[model samples]
Target: MSEEELNARHAEKMKKKKAARDKILATKTIEKGLLIVHTGKGKGKSTAAFGLVFRALGNGLKVGVVQFVKGKWETGERKILEHFPEQVTMTAMGDGFTWETQDRQRDIEAAKAAWERAKAMIMDEEHQMVLLDEMNIVLRYDYLDIADVIEFLKTKPADKHVIVTGRNAKDELIELADLVTEMEMVKHPFRAGVKAQKGIEF
Candidate 1:
């Protein structure tokens, strides 16, 4: 085909694509909060959740964050969010990972306390988005009752968005979530003897 003919064909194809996309978008009228879950044996689960928090902040929405693990370490996101106290309420409640603590009972207590704070944030009218960082890790260990957590989440305020991130998400939680993402790790630097670095890992 001539160059002019090729240009015309491409334009026609894009026009049809745009029309189809618009039609589908018009049918999606319902707007409400979402129960979003990020889980898998891969990196970037928590990173993705933090990205949503930043997006919410950009839109002038209030956010609440409860970190169930990595509380002892000072993370870059935590430091940045601290500057927006009026729009963000963050609590890092974990003592550290389970192996670091080495006490099952202590881990359970910490999980319980973090859940209490998380529940409060979910119910609080001021917050529009609440991020439950590493919640699945605690759930995987049975540190908190899954039944209770699911029930509470079911009854959360209709206009509030809840985000849970960590590996090994429970079957029940995945079933109840409105949106779920699983990260598949094809490669990672840790396997190549590169330790977790600032800004990249944390």
Candidate 2:
């Protein structure tokens, strides 16, 4: 085909694509709070949730974060979010991972304490977005009852957004979420003998 013919054909395809995209966009008119879930074996679940925290802050919204695990280590995101005290409320409640703590009862107690803070944040009308960081891990270990969590989520304000992140998310939670993203593991640096790097992993 001639170059002129190729250009014309490309333009026609793009025009059709644009029209289809616009039509789909027009159909999405519902606006309400979203229950977003990020779960899978792959990384970036909590990272993705934190990205939304920045988005909420940028939009002048207040956010509440309850870290159910990884409470011993200091993360870069936590340091940054702490600077925005007026917009962000963070509570790191876990002592550490279950294996590290080596006490089932201790883990359960920690989880219960964290859930109280999370519920408080959820009930607070001032927070526009709430992040339950690594909540799936606790749920997987049965630290808290899934049914109770779902009931609490259902009671949240209509305009409040909630994000739950961790691996092995429960099926019940996924069913209730408005948006669910499962990060499939394609490849990881740990397999290649790379330790968790600063800023990137922590």
TM-score of each: 0.95, 0.94
lDDT of 2 by residue, 1-202 (tens): 9999999999999999999999999999988989999999987898899999988898899999999986534468878887788999888875687888899998899999999999998888889999999999999999999999999898888888999999999999999999999998899999999987787787
Number of the top TM-score candidate: 1
Q: After TM-score superposition, what is the CA distance of residue 113 in candidate 2 from its true location, in Å?
A: 1.1
Q: Rate the local accuracy (lDDT) of all candidates.
A: 0.91, 0.90
Assess candidate 1 and give its lDDT. 0.91
lDDT of 2 at 152: 87
Residue 195 shift from truth in candidate 1, angstroms: 2.3
Number of the top lDDT candidate: 1
lDDT of 1 at 53: 97
**Per-residue lDDT of candidate 1, residues 47-135 (tens digit):** 89999999999899999999898654446887888878899998876668788888888889989999999999999899999999999
Q: How many residue pairs in model 1 have overlapping backbones?
A: 0
